[model samples]
Structures are given as structure tokens and as C-alpha cells.
Target: MPATPSTILVVEDDDIVRMLIVDVLQELGFSVLEADGSARAIELLEDTNQRIDLLMTDVGLPGMDGRALAQKARELRQSLPILFASGYADTVEVEEGMAIIGKPFSIDQLRDKVKSMLGI
Candidate 1:
């Protein structure tokens, strides 16, 4: 059987980077949702109609930051998977089981991480 399409929430403050990641995922045939910041990303994840298979967010964000957002999201949905991406990923501490993709990533890196997280 073919795999189901997974709705992925991408939270990034940088428009270019966000678009790049979205383009890569879309090219790989995955469903995508975007949010410029943590608050908006939370809104998408909390939407009853949306079933987010995974969340891919930048580590540095204005106001709520990605770590806090991921923590809060974990509280709301324990089964949700999260991946953090940043140029300064080493500076940010994250939980176990959560993956981190460094900035300046290749399309292959992003695709592989998403696939691993989604267990594809």
C-alpha cells in the first residue's frame, strides 16, 4: 500500500528558509502547512481539523521560541513528532527523540530527516 500524506507544520521566521524547506517537502510529495512564528504554528497544530504528522520549526523564533513551542505542543499532543532546524542548533538544547537539522541543509538531508521522523 502507498503511504498516507502527512500534514507537516513548518514554523520559521525567515521567509526564504521557510519557503525552501516547504518547496523541498512539497517536491517530495508531502502535505505542508506554514507558520511564521510559534504562536501561529500553535494555532495550526491545535486546529481540530488538522492532523499534523510532524512539526519542523526553526530553533530561534520571536516571543515564544521553538523549544518552548515544542514543549507546549508536547503537552497538547504527546504523540506529535518535532524537528528543530537552525544555523545555531548547537546553542539550543532540545529533548530526547527530537531531531535537529542544521542550517544550510541539502534537500536530501531535510527529506531523510522528515522520513525518519515519520517512520517512512
Candidate 2:
């Protein structure tokens, strides 16, 4: 039997960017959940029934920001994997267990990084 596709929660402030990412991820055979900002993302994260396998968030988000959101998420789901998408990827530093991907990444790069993180 085939394994179930991993579910990724994508938190991005840009509507078009988020849509493109969601489309690309869905096309690549992964289940995707999207949130425009930290508030909605937190609501989704708080939902116990949701099986979120990974969190891919933009680092330059408004209000709470991606790092803060990741910290809050960890409080709720300790083992959750976080992937920060940043425009300044080379300079971005993540926590020991977290990862980073540069902004304007190619479809292939995004796919590879996400799959590698999820081990899918």
C-alpha cells in the first residue's frame, strides 16, 4: 500500500506567492493547508485534529513574524518540523532542528527541500 501524503501548513503573507506554493505542493502530491497570517496559522495549529506534518512559513511576515509563530507552534506540537522561507536565505539562521529555504526558489528546489524534510 502507498503511504499517505504528508500534510504541510504553509504560512505566507503574500496571496499570490502562497497560492503558487500551494499549487506547486498540491501538484507534487502533498496535502497542503494555507494561512495568510500568523493568526489564522495559529488557529490551524491549535486544532488538535489536524495532522500537520510540516510547517513552511515566510520569515518576513507581519505582526508576530515567522520565528515567533514557529515558537508558538512548538509549544503546541513539540516535534513539528519548521522550514523558514526567507529572502535572505544565506544569512538566515534557524534553530537546531529547523531548516531554511531561500525565497524565489525554483519548483524543484522547493519540492526537494520539502520532501527531504518530510522524508517522503
Candidate 3:
């Protein structure tokens, strides 16, 4: 039997960027859940019983930033893989065991990074 597609929770404040990421992840055969900010993302995380394989979020977000969100998410789901997307590379530091993809990344780059993180 084939394994189920990994579910990724994407938290991006920009609408266009979030749409693009969702489209790419869907096309790449992974299930995607999108949120425009940290609050919504946390709501989804708290409400879902399904297994989420990854959390891809922007470093800058309104209300609760991505780093705070990632920390909260890890509390909810231990050792959840995270990919922090940021346009400001100089300000963003990649955490241990967590992945970071700069903004304006190509579809292949996003797919490759997610695949490597998920061990797909």
C-alpha cells in the first residue's frame, strides 16, 4: 500500500505568496493547509487531529511571528519539522534541525527542501 501524502501547514502573511506555495505543494503531491497569520495557524493546529508532517512559515508575521508560532507548534507536536521562509536573510537565523528557504525560491527548491525534510 502506498503511504499517505504528508500534510504541511503553511503560514504566510502575504496572500499571493501563500497561494503560490499552496499551489506548488499541491502539485508536488503533498497535502497543504494555509493560514495568513500565526493566529489562524494556531487555531488550525489546535483543531486538527490529522498528522501534520511539516510547518512552513514566513519569518515575519503579524501578531505572533513565525518563530513564536513554530515554538508553539512544537509544543503541540513534538519535533515537527519546520521551514522558515524569509526575504530578509540577514535578520533570519536558521534554527538547529530546522530548515530555512529564502524568499523568491523556485518551485524546485521548495519541493526539494520539503521532500528532504519529510524524507519522502
lDDT of 1 by residue, 18-85 (tens): 89889889889999999999889988878878888899988889999889999988987897899999
Per-model root-mean-square deviation over C-alphas:
1.4, 1.2, 1.7
Stronger candidate by TM-score (2 vs 3): 2
Clash pairs, candidate 3, are none
Expressed as tens digits, the lDDT of each residue in 1-120 for candidate 3 is: 127889999999999999999999999888899999999898888875866889999989988999999999888877889999988856777666588998889999999999889877
Q: Which candidate ranks first by lDDT, i.e. highest?
A: 2
TM of each candidate vs. truth: 0.93, 0.96, 0.92
Candidate with the larger TM-score of 1 and 2: 2
| TM-score for candidate 3 | 0.92
Residue 17 lDDT in candidate 3: 91
Q: Which stretches of candidate 2 lie over 4 Å from their true place?
A: none
On residues 5-92, what C-alpha lDDT tens digit does candidate 2 reach at each position?
8999999999999999999999999999999999999999999999999999999999999999999999999999999999999998
Candidate 1 accuracy as TM-score: 0.93
Candidate numbers, best TM-score first, in rank order:
2, 1, 3
Clashing pairs in 2: none
Q: Report RMSD for candidate 2.
A: 1.2
Query: After superposition, which runs of candidate 3 have C-alpha atoms over 4 Å from their true positions?
Result: none
lDDT value for candidate 2? 0.94
